[model samples]
Target: MVNNRSLVIIALLAVLAWLASTSLYVVNETQRAIKLRFGEVVETDIAPGLHAKWPLINTVHTFDARVQTLENGQSRFLTAGRNALIVDSFLKWRVVDPNRFYQATRGSTDRAEALISPRVEQSLRNAFGSRDVNTIISEDRDDMLADSMASLDTAMRDEIGVEILDIRLKRVELPEQVTQAVYQRMSTERHAEARQYRAQGQEQSERIRAHADRQREIALANARKEADRLRGEGDGEAANIYANAYKQEPEFARFYRSMQAYRKSFEGNNDILVIGPKSDFFRYLEHPAGGASK
Candidate 1:
């Protein structure tokens, strides 16, 4: 009787331990959980802490409630101009509604990704299709991404219980078969731009040189005019002085003139004159006293 009682007590303790183990669960701040009863969802978004449920009847599912990233590999898209481009992209998302997320993706992250990726690809394709190559590659790229993120978030939140945080293009490139042709076209465009800049520089240089030449000509003309005015003033002053001297003494003026002529004629000792002896040049030499025939 004592042995049977001890065995019965051990079995009861084991059953209680099993019930406790199955009923109690812990949830952390970084995790989100859902409870199911007989494969039917009963509770979603369970708060973090110790919780109790019906032993052996309730099931709990936990998921990481953190932001996640998905890197979708390169995909080819067509621009408005019908040019093909390879776009490498990534996505950021997080589960906001656990119940809806569970229903839409059946708690399979891979399935969620599979559904989200097609939408992203389709969005990108549409965006690229409506824009030219240059616009798609450079100008409207950020705008397109912003628009895509908004559209994707709306669509996903409405259908998948997942919120799209962002979508970004890692890289954009041309197809291998068209890379050389595209490169050549880009090179040609750059060369043309360089030529245009050079032409503009040359045109500006020519304008500057022409202006400088015009300024130089004007400066030279002004200098010549000033020089001619100064020369005229000097000549007039000299004539006035000569007239005043002649008025003071007429005979002295004439004798001074004759002396100047003789000095000029015999400025050098090697000078020779072949004139008549009674020439007016000899009048002063003949008189040499008071005066000569003026």
Candidate 2:
């Protein structure tokens, strides 16, 4: 009788422990929980805490409520010019309505992402639809995506219960053929510009050099003319001096001229003169007087 009473008390305590274990649950600070009654959502978003539920009648589904990132790589879209672009981008989002999120994705993160990715891609496509590669590269990309971003955020909030906090573009690229063509065109344009610059430089340099050469020629001619004038004036003054000396003393002038001639005639030892003894050239040698020895 004592052993039966002890066994009954132990069994009752064990059942109570099992019930408590099943009925009580905990939700972390970074998580959100949903209470479902027989797989039908009864309580929407249960805040983070220890919560109680009817054992075996209600269950809890918890999800990470923190912000999440969806990496979108290599999504192809068309431009206004009908050219193709490969876009690499990412999205920042979080679940705002856990009930709707659970309903739409059935608590599957993968399913939520699959639904969100196509919409993001479509919004990006809409933004890119009016722009070509040239316009995209050369213009403000923010203006292009502003309307689409807002619209996508609204749509994601409504449909997937996810809030789009941000969208970012990592890279936008063209096909190999298009890239090569663009490079070739740019090279040709650069070459043409360089040729034009060189041509202008050469023309200006030639003009400057020609102007310098002309100025040099003018300066040399002026110098030569001045030199000639000065030389002619010197010779004329010397002739006038000689005339004045001769007018002052005719006999002295003749004697001085005769001496100068004799000095030059015997200036070099190798000099020789052969003349008649009675030549008028020897009149000075024959006599010292101006009239010679008669």
Candidate 3:
């Protein structure tokens, strides 16, 4: 009977040891815990190590409070200008207010993700709806994201009570239909620009040709006028020289004119002349002894 009593005591000590070991749990440097008694949360501990609770009456729930990175899948959304774009995004988040997170999501990280994802999508849609396609795709995209992050911060804080470390866009793309349409429009615009440039060049060429033609016409007209003026001046000068010579000495002028005519008429190797002695052609050679003055 004493041996049976000793065995019962040893079994009780063993049970007690097991209970004590299960009741107390040590949290790691990166972990946090919450205590629950009969489906009610009794306490939450953030600092690591050596925590105590009632044996078999209390339960401990541990959570990873470290920062986590989540990469979102690509999604299609419309810009404010009604242009469609494919956007890929990512976020960094942590479990802030683990108590609220546990109550809201029931201590499941997947549940927390399910709750956060829709809000992120909603925020993305709202931000995307407030900007044009050019702004979203261009260098100004950083500014657009900045604005979106601010908006996300406000929304997440007010609604989820969770701190979003950062939200970033990985890529933005045009849908196939939108891409084809944009390419066609760009091609048409380039063709129009080329047409405009060709038209301008043609106009400039025509203007240069017209200007050259006008200059040529002006030069030809001036040359003709100068030629006619010089011809008239030359004729007038010749007529004046003749008149002056005749006025100076009438007889000498007649003799000189006859000599010039003879020179021109007799210049060729072959020549003929016919004249009477009594004619004026031989008057200068007549002597007074051979003919009477009367």
Q: Please, what is the TM-score per model?
A: 0.81, 0.79, 0.62
* Ordered list by lDDT, greatest first: 1, 2, 3
- Of the two candidates 2 and 3, the one with more favorable lDDT, higher being better, is 2
lDDT score, candidate 3: 0.78
Model 3 CA deviation exceeding 4 Å by range: 1-13, 154-161, 194-294
For residues 1-294, write the lDDT of model 1, one tens digit per residue.
999999999999999999889999998998888999998999999999999999768998887789989898999998899989999999999988888888888888899999999999999898889888777656755677788789889999889889999888899988999999878999999999999999999999999999999999999999999999999999999999999999998767877888999899999999998998777777768876535446
lDDT of 2 by residue, 1-294 (tens): 999999999999999999989999999999878999999999978988999999889989888889899998888889999988889999888888888889899888889899988988989998788887788888776777778778988998889788888888999998667888978999999999999999999999999999999999999999999999999999999999999999999989998998999899989999999987667677877877757544
Worst 10 residues of 1 by lDDT: 285-294
Question: Who wins the TM-score comparison?
Answer: 1
lDDT of candidates 1 onward, in order: 0.89, 0.88, 0.78
Which stretches of candidate 1 lie above 4 Å from their native place? Answer: 1-13, 137-143, 176-180, 196-215, 218-222, 268-270, 276-279, 283-290
lDDT of 2: 0.88
